[model samples]
Target chain A: MTTYYTKSHEWIRLDGEEATVGITAHASEELGELVFVEAKDEGTEVAAGDTAAVVESVKAASDIYAPVAGTLSGFNTKLSDEPTLVGSDAEGEGWIYKMTVSNPDDLKGLLTAEQYKSL
Target chain B: MSDTLHQTPLHALNLELGAKMVPFAGYEMPIQYKAGLMAEHLHTRSSAGLFDVSHMGQLRIAAKSGDVRDAALALETLIPADYAALGVHRQRYGLLTNDEGGIRDDLMVANMGQDLFVVVNASCKHQDADLIEKALGDRCIVTRHFDRALIALQGPEAQNALTSLCPAAADMKFMDAIETELAGVSVTLSRSGYTGEDGYEIGIAAKDAETVARALLAQPQILPIGLGARDSLRLEAGLCLYGNDIDPTTTPIEASLAWAIQKARREGGSREGGYPGADIVLRQAREGVSRKRVGLMAEGRAPVRAGAKLFADAEGTKEIGVVTSGAFGPTVNAPVAMGYVATEFADVDTALFAELRGKFVPVHVRAMPFVAPGFKR
Candidate 1:
């Protein structure tokens, strides 16, 4: 499994054709406390840079873009009941959704952990 | 973003408390701290929360005649509130209206017997000062207090925390103001705040602001809060933010603030129709406006934030209103918002739809002050 990061602060863990996505810790910290989270329904196909989800904090709302073109297979429904988990454990249990990639080659263009940290 | 951004007297103390700094209204202020907005908001409701609101502008208005009533009567020409009738040591909420009956700014005016103490929004302070000076300069002295710093101690436990430092604070009712000493420092204390909580807004010398703030924070019941919580608390209270909820495009009658304009200033009263935009404001008071601001209760968890257009139907064909301020209320345990809509749709429980992220979501028109105020009065 390899973790890939995007300039917009979304991170994806890729394994074979399956992938899990969530916001980076830096992004979570910037967003402060999360009050609500919503994403496209399961099986919704989205292209790279398209808005797939939204996260709201007490002060403002922000869009979570799709990291790569893929069909959303599942969502982290727990966020619907416990949105603060995104602020507490954004990288793990707070993962927003799961998807099946249409093209694995798209992963090669994302930044590594080192490059994302420098960014 | 620029080095030119102003820093409050408590800026260094905010950094020491692990605050997340952000630029707002030409000042570098704390948006939240380690506890975040939720914790700070809840704490302010249950206990005491200390807030640094130093960026707001404060000034003194006094007539050359040496009587506060003269100044208040003179100021009545600028705002719609009844200031001449306001008792000494008492404060009233006021609005600065333009010739078109639109709100230029909303402010608090405290009658200090010999002079009137006023506070205005930070973003419009310079313009407001110039307006007052230019309008009333011949009859009154409008002295801007650039050397002052303001702080608020809010919540149910606010009185308890404050009386420990200034014992006389316990005797004050809501909207009462007093020039007193706190921790051996001279400060003007007002038993009023933007939050619906029972609290006090203290104005101190810029040099002594940090000392008084630290003294208040030293109380076990008081925790330092930031602007993020302040905003949520005010939204829950249904109070208007000058630039956001009420602007130059909004009027007192249209914003559901008619109550703030005392009967003495209305038509048929002793002093009638002298303020700016009096013709439109008074006529609206009698005839009603085409659109009016109302509280919005959005269905579901997602917040229907400001800039969301409201419609009469979910299909998003006919637009009726637009949200001014919206946020997730931690105390209310739901998303709450304020917006303007057609007068017919402004009734309580009227169903409206808000377009959020290209999808129209259900919202209901609701009465404001989502949470009841905890004022001592």
Candidate 2:
């Protein structure tokens, strides 16, 4: 198992062909109290790096991009009613979506958990 | 961040409390605290939120001779509201307009005695003072209460939280004001505020303002709120800030504040006091304006923001209005915004669309005050 991060601040934890994706804690803190989170539909195919979600706060609006090329399998539907869960636990309970990693090699080029921490 | 920004007496206290500071009206003021905007905003609606509003200028206006109300009447000629009708110890919201009928600033006038009281706001205080001075002539005197610092203790906990600081304050009614001592400082306490809650705006002596603020913030419910939460909280309460909601380009009638107009002024039974754009004002009261400010409740969780274009959702691309104030309303726990739309779109069920990042967000034209106001009055 390995974790990868995008420059846009999204993270993907890859396990074979399956990957779990969510925004970095840094992104959530910067966004302030999360008021709304809009994730892509399940099975939505994206051409890697596409804006996959919208994250809103009391003060700002931001787009979350797809870190690795894949089809979104499902989303954390709990986000609609409890967006602050992202602020509370961005890495675990706050995971945004699960996807099938179309190209597992995409993970190698992304930032490691240690490298992402330095940011 | 601007070096030109002013600092309130409790500026250091706000920093000490880990507040998020922001520039507001040339002043470095706190917008929220470590609890952040949402918690502070929700707390203000449910409990109480202490705000350091010392950056706002508090001043006194009086007539050296006759009743200040009579003098205020003469001064009212320069404003859109009928000031002479205000009861002593009460307060009313008002605006200063130019010859074009556009608002110069929105302000609050508290009747201290028959002839004297305080008026306050940020950025517009100086100009507001000058306008009042120019209109008074020999009839009244306007003096700056620069020796004082203004603090707003707003919300349900306000009455109780203030009791420890000023015991006499508990007896005050909404919009009612009285001179009292708090934190060993003589202060003019007014049961008024911008957050649409039962609160008091305390004008403490400059030297003692920090002491009073410290004493108020000592309580658990009294979190130090800054400018960011101040904006969202007021939006939730459906209160208007001068710059975003009303400005030089807007008018009282257009702003939907015609209630501030004195009934006598509309009747024309008394002497007609001269003021800028009085003719157009009376005419507006008789008929109505083409546009009006109304509340908007979105169909989804995506909140409409200020400057978002408003269009008829069904009619397609026809631009009708634009949002002036907006946010996810903390009190109502939903997104709400206020904007000016054509009179035809001001009804409760009028369907509208807010263009956000190219997406047309569905909206409905609702009444003002997205949430209920808890002013003591």
Best by TM-score: 1
Residues B1-377 of candidate 2 have per-residue lDDT tens digits of 77787788887888899977878778888877898888888888888988888877777777777577766776677776666777787777777888877888777787777555756577888888788887876678888875467888899999998898789888888888788788788888889888878899888777887888888888877878767788887887777888888888877788888776666655473634256776776677678888899989888787888899999864448999999988887667778899999988888879899998667888998877877889765
True contacts kept of each: 0.89, 0.44
Task: For candidate 1, give the lDDT of residue B362.
Answer: 98
True contacts kept of 2: 0.44
lDDT for each residue of candidate 1 in B58-118, tens digit (9 for 90 to 100): 9999999998899999999999888989999999999999998999999999998889999
Model 2 local distance difference test score = 0.81
- On a 0 to 100 scale, what is the lDDT of residue A13 in model 2? 94
- Model 1 misplaced stretches (Cα beyond 4 Å): none
TM-score of each: 0.98, 0.90
